[model samples]
Target: MNEQQRVMQIFQAYREVNQAFFQVMAKVAQKHGLTPLQLIVLRILKEFPDIKLMELSDKLNLGNSTTSGIVDRMVKAGIITRERTESDRRAMTLKLSDKGTTLWEESNDMRLMLLRPLLGLSEEDQQQFHRIQTEILTILKTIKGDVLHD
Candidate 1:
């Protein structure tokens, strides 16, 4: 194959791998009684506790209306709570409830399971995998304009 065709093949393989990974995550999330997006919300809330709707929307690259609907369903499921701040009592913020925390922990364990076998690799291979995954993540983050600030 020509160099251009080879590059396109690599891209296609990468896309297929990503799609398969997401599909697996979706199935796992569904088994845990949460949609994939809801599981994401829980994890993000764990990292950025009590984030506001607009900020969460921005972080997820989703519209405020769409984010709000997701938040509403999570609240109904007792997975999250929306509270008002003293500074702006009219505006609500997102927080993982105790149940949400438990669910997040559980879902996180499931997510880790997908890559857990990598830990059992020989030390050299494990280190190489770690480095490669980290580099790939950095590249993807940069491409998406989600560069780490610190």
Candidate 2:
């Protein structure tokens, strides 16, 4: 195949792999009675407890209304707590409830499941794969603006 064709083939393979990975992750999240986005919210709250609504929206790359809706549902489900910050009573902060914390911990198995394929690779191959993935990410970020313009 020509160079361009080879590049397209590789891109297709990468896309397929990413889709499969997310499909499995979604299934696992569903099993835990959480959507994939909700699982991500739980992760962020665990790492950055008591975060503000706007800040969480920024992290999630979502609009305030959308994030607020997600937060509202989580609060209703008793998985998260929302309260006014002491320093800024007008603004609210979010935190994972005790149940949310336990759920997040239990979700550790999902991480392990995702990593299982990579763990099966030889040590050298795994390191090489990591290096290649990092390099690709750096290159993509560098050209992202230029690529988006088209």
For 1-150, candidate 1 gives per-residue lDDT tens digits of: 999999698679879978988897897798889998998898899999979999999989999999999999999999999999889889888899999999999888887887687578799997887797788778878977854553
Error of 1 at 84 (Å): 0.2
Q: What CA RMSD would you report for each candidate?
A: 4.4, 1.9
Best by TM-score: 2
Model 1 residue 101 CA deviation in Å: 0.9
Q: What is the lDDT of candidate 2?
A: 0.90
Q: Highest lDDT among the candidates is held by which one?
A: 2
Q: Pairing residues by index, what is the TM-score of model 1?
A: 0.80
- The alpha-carbon lDDT assigned to residue 13 of candidate 2 equals 82
List lDDT for all candidates, in order. 0.89, 0.90
Q: Give the TM-score of candidate 2.
A: 0.89
After the best TM-score superposition of candidate 2, give how far the Cα of residue 13 lies from its true spot, in angstroms. Answer: 2.1
Taking the tens digit of each residue's C-alpha lDDT, what string does model 2 give over 43-115? 9999999999999999999999999999999999999999898987898989999999988888757767766
- Would you estimate the TM-scores of all the predictions? 0.80, 0.89
Candidate 2 deviant stretches above 4 angstroms: 148-150
